[model samples]
Target: MDGTIAATSKTDARGKQKDKSPRLRKRSGFVFILPWFIGFLCFTAGPMLFSLVMSFMNWDYMQNMTFVGFANYVKAFTQDPFFFPSIRRTLHFTAFAVPIQVVLGILIANLFNKKLKGKKVFRALVYLPCVLSGAIYGLVWNNMLNTDFGVFNYFIQALGGEKVEWLADPKITIWALIMTAIWAAGMPMILFLGAMQNIPDHYYEAAEIDGAGGFRQFFSITLPMITPTILFVIILQLISSFTVMAQVLALTGGGPAKATYLYSLLVYENAFKYMKMGYASALSWIMFLIVMGITIVLFLSSRKWVYYEEKGGNI
Candidate 1:
């Protein structure tokens, strides 16, 4: 009888320990994460909620705080003259810059993957631009693209070609910004390289055994295998291109007759330059919605193209 009682107590204790273990672990995890959670509530979530509330008001960075409901949103859609133009400019940048960045990144990654002398040095140089601050990058490129005594113009002049106003020309300023964007394709290049390295060598061997050439192997094996990485790069580049700000602010200041005036510039100008804080908040939410919409579309469309090797199917 005593033995049976002791056994029951042991079982109950074990059960209690099992239940308490997870609770204790959960408590520790919460304790560890408390700092970040508090920070998010205090700084990020608080500010975001504040901005969302301000979007419905008519606060002009001063004493005014009249609630105007959907007036700001309606104004952005219909009354603001720069709205469509800025949206167009931002999308134009996205269309051109994202593809070029993806292409350049892939090509550079492929080149660096090959066995070559000083490959490590070359890789470092290519990724150098990504580590640079946006303002510094703009300042560097500003000098490089200058028509008078700039490196680009110096080369053109050397080849008996006329100096082209890369930034000063309204038509060319957007292209110049796109050029800077292309130069910053280093992060995607690194990502592509990592993805390419992860591809199984046996697939390439099988392709070679079937009498496939280099291009055939790349297209049939490498490109298909890396479609997942390509999708990731595309989404990242799209987001970056759409929300581009510091480079334009430092380089042209949306100058040359507002040719490079992007959507982000409009939001910034309204918020700080013009002191339309409420309107700027509305614009910000609109930008978030646009980006969220595009991201959703990309994710939905990815089912068609993104390949998962482990799953042996498209994502």
Candidate 2:
């Protein structure tokens, strides 16, 4: 009976150990991610919350915070002169740039995927802009787009055309930025190449066996397979285009006029340059809502286009 009682106690201890093991694992995982969690809360979430609060207030860095209750937001929509133009310019850039980049990426990826000589070198050459310093690229392009003695205008002159004001004219400045963006379209192409490589060879083989030509195969098989990647690239480009400021700052500094003054640059100017923190916060929130809304629409519409193999091609 004493031996039996000792066995029962041992079994109970074993069961207790099993219970504590899961708790210990949970604690260990929390401890492992504690640094990231703390950093997120302190840096990302904390600042976002603070910014949200500040959006409703009238506080500069050196002043008392007075809660104005949507005054900043209302002012941004109704009174601010830059608000609509900035949004319109940013959206205009996005509308043009994203589609061009997407198509260019697809074409480059297709070219890179083909079994051609010196393909690796071509890939690296195309992707160089993506990895190279953006500031350097901006400086180089800034000079290249100069009205006189610039490579682009020199070529145009060689063709007996006029030297265009690529950067100076407000009418042409936005297009110049668009051209710069397209020049760096190689990253998305590389991404699409990755997506393209993942597509099963059997699909292509079957299409060929069915007498489908190159265009037919691409339209029916390749494109369908890469729709998910296309969606991802579009979303990424959308966000990037909307928040583009540093490159614009380096190149045009919002232009010969405010023609290239994007929405994000407007926010930065208000926050840091003009010291209108509250107003800037309102602009930031508006930009966030715009992006979030567009992203949501994309996602909701993605069910029709974004093919997920894991879902067995079902929405």
Candidate 3:
């Protein structure tokens, strides 16, 4: 009778353990990934799949998708003269704007990270440009940069220089765009500030004790400590840079002889303005491939320069 009771108790215990295991594991997994899973399906995965399907069909929102196989893609390469030019313009913008932003953001972030008087107010001032609407920002800058009466040109003239049409001339127009885009570097600046603050002061103190000057300490200690943040910011900037359409739309509009017609603008024009949905999708897919390839290359090459504090927590 005692043996029977013991057997029964063991069986019940095993059953309870089995039930609890699945429940605990399931709840943990759900808790860990609910947000990401929802975001991926709703925002990332769904859009990607939908775009993929749209790329194969010539749809204009008025008619059914007419399957054209590879014609749209072929035309983008072979028939479109604007395609290469737009790509070149985009590359130019990315190359020029990204480094400038990164350097400026880092500098500003480091500055704000230090204990200074009214630092919060200064940081807020720096970040003000990020909250403004693109069109509004464009209009404001347009008025401020106007050749005949804009405030900037007026100041330049007052400082013994001629007024320059910032947006009309090709050479100056691209530079104007670069300047405007750099203003939005405030967010990255804030991000860098946070990363810098998170870094322990012990590293800098140790470097100083070892006879390191400010520049040396910055290069050796500060840079390596914040490399992960740099890598993350660069990746995000690369992806975002490819889609630099809003500023171009408001400021340049492909401008004096199609100099600043970025790929995104080109895609938008073809897709919506001209009803060339299939061709637009092809352009978008090409952009996707370029971005993906660059990202993969960066990931593979990150071992050379990306210094991580821990072994496996790469951003």
Candidate 4:
């Protein structure tokens, strides 16, 4: 009876140990991510909450705090003349730049995916621009796109075309910015390349066996498989384009008649330069809402097109 009791106690202890193992693993995982959670709460969440509250109050470093309700928001829309134009310009830049970046990224990625000579060198050249500082790139392009005596103009003159005022003319400045954006398409290209390489070789092999040509195989197999990556790249590029400021500030400084005045630059001017903190906060919240709305729409639409292998095709 003593031996049987000892054996029963050992069995219960073993079962308890087995139950605690999963709990231990979960606790360890949470512990590993605790720092990130704490940082997010302290830095990100804290600032966002503070900014939300400030948006409704007339806040300035030099002035007394006054609760203004939605007056700040109303002033942004009705009183500020630069507000709507900035939004339009930002949207225009996004519209042109994102599509071009997506296309160029896909093409460059496809090129890199091919088995060719000097492939590593080509890949490095393509990715090199992504590492360059945005401000530095803007400065370099600003000089390059100079109306007279710039390399671009020299080439145009050699070809008997007129010297184009790239950054100086309001009509052409936005396009110049868009061109600069296209040049920095390296990140999305690298992402696309990674996604393409992850696709199983067996799929392409099977397509070849089915007498599908290269173009047909790409359209039917490669594209469908890479739709998820495309969606991710689009959303990321969209957000970046909308929030673009450094390049615009460096190159055009909101430019030849505020033609290139992005929404971000406008917000910065109001907050720091103009000392209109409340208005800036309102603008920031508006931008937040716009970005969130677009992202939500993208996510909802992605369910129809974004393919996932685990979901048997799309989710």
Candidate 5:
């Protein structure tokens, strides 16, 4: 009886130690991430919470805040004339730019995947534009697309075509911006190339063995396999497109007639240029909601289209 009791005590102590081991490890893990947690709370969550509160007030930096409680939001929706136009312009740019970027990225990535001569050089050249500073990109394009004495206009004139105002004409300015966006498809192209290379060679070989042609194999195998990367790129590009301000600021400065005033640019103008802090905060929250809604819709829609290899099915 004494021996049995001693053994039972030892076992219980061992079990207790085992239980404490996990708790200790968890505490250590939390300690390791404590700095990041504190940073997020102080810098990210704190500011967002403050912004939410500010959105309800009527405050300029020079005066005490007045608690308006949704007045700013109401004004933005019903009173502000530029609000809707900015939203529309942002949406217009996003709609035109994201799809073209995705398609071009995929096409270029496919070209890079091919075992062709000087492919490395071509790949590097394609990726070069993505590294250019946005301000520089905008300035360069501004000069190149100028109506008179621009490189593009010179080429058009040489080809016996009329000089077109690429940036000045409101009708074509957005299109020109879209063209500029397409040039920076290098990031997505590289992602797609990585995804393509990860696909097993046997799959292509099997498709060929089954009498499948190149295009058929690409559509049926390559596209479906790379759908996850496509979804990721689409979400990122969508967010970036909506928040685009630097290029517009550097190139058009909200345009000749405010035709290129994106939502983010409008926010910037209100925040800094006009010093309407409360109103800008409200606008930012509205833009946040819009972005969240669109992202949620995309995620929900992706369930039918995005294929997950680990899950062995579409997600």
Candidate 6:
């Protein structure tokens, strides 16, 4: 009986030690993550907290900060007419750019997914615009769309039409910018292509066997299967479009009565050029809130559209 009790106690101790081993492993993992945690606190979290604090105060780099307590926000919403206009312009850009990119991405991805010779070269060529710098792309497009001595205008002239000041005319400038933005749809197209390739061949084969036509199969199977990736791309594009500064800066510089004055441009002008650091911080926080709110709304709405292969199985 004494020997059995001793063995049982030893087994219990061994079991406890096994449990303690995982705890030790967890502690070591945390130790390994400590540097990254510290860096995040110093770089990301610290700057974000500093910005929040600064936003509530009146501070220029040259002077001491004085707490004004939401006055900057009030001014942004009420007194600054530029703020609302910037928001409207940003939303307009996002609304146009996101859907256009997503639909075009899907179209291009579907086309590329087909078996063809020189497919690899075609893919690379299509993706080239995405790899090029945004500023360079904008400059190139701006030259192309120029009223005089431009290829587009030359074509228009050949077709018996007058030159259009694509960038200078507020009515038509947004369309010109949209054309520039669409060239970078190559990235999202690549993403959609990747998602498309991951889809099993069995689904298509099964659909074919069921006598489903090409369009029907695409609508019923291909689209639903790809919905999650599409949703992700749309959200990313929307966020990116909101902060699109480089293209507008290089191409139009918010041209023709500030029609293209994005919120980021306004923030840049305030913080750097005007030395309104507090006001800029306030603007940044408001923009952050707007993005977060939109993201939340998308997430909530995605339940109706986004598909998971594991759950309910359809879009």
- Kindly list the per-residue Cα lDDT of model 4 for residues 174-237, writing each as its tens digit: 9899989998788889899999999899998998999999899878987888898998999999
Clashes of 2: 0
Q: 2 or 6, which is superior by lDDT?
A: 2
Measured against the true structure, the TM-scores of the candidates, in listed sequence, are 0.90, 0.92, 0.86, 0.89, 0.90, 0.89
- Model 4, CA-based lDDT: 0.87
Worst 10 residues of 5 by lDDT: 20-29
| lDDT (C-alpha) at residue 67 in model 2 | 97
Candidate 6: Cα lDDT at 37: 99
Worst 10 residues of 4 by lDDT: 20-29
Off by over 4 Å in 4: 1-31, 311-315
Using TM-score as the measure, which candidate wins? 2
160-267: candidate 3 lDDT, tens digit per residue: 998898977877887888788899888788888888988898888888789999889778877788888887888888877889777677776778677677889899
The lDDT for every candidate, in the order shown, is: 0.88, 0.88, 0.82, 0.87, 0.87, 0.86
For model 1, the superposed segments whose C-alpha errors exceed 4 Å read 1-21, 311-315
Candidate 6 stretches with Cα past 4 Å from truth are 1-24, 311-315
- Clash numbers, per candidate: 0, 0, 0, 0, 1, 0
Error of model 6, residue 229, in angstroms? 0.4
Pairs that clash in candidate 3: none
RMSD of 5: 6.9
Off by over 4 Å in 3: 1-18, 21-43
Per-residue lDDT of 14 in model 5: 81
lDDT of 6 by residue, 1-315 (tens): 456555545555686755545654454456656789999999999999999999999988789999999999999999998999989888878888888899999988888888877877878898898877878877888889888777889999999999988978887887777767787788899899999899899999999999999899889987898998887898799889988988888888888788888899999999999999999999999999999999999889989998875556454
TM-score attained by model 4: 0.89
How does candidate 5 score on lDDT?
0.87
- Tell me the RMSD of model 4 versus the true structure: 6.6
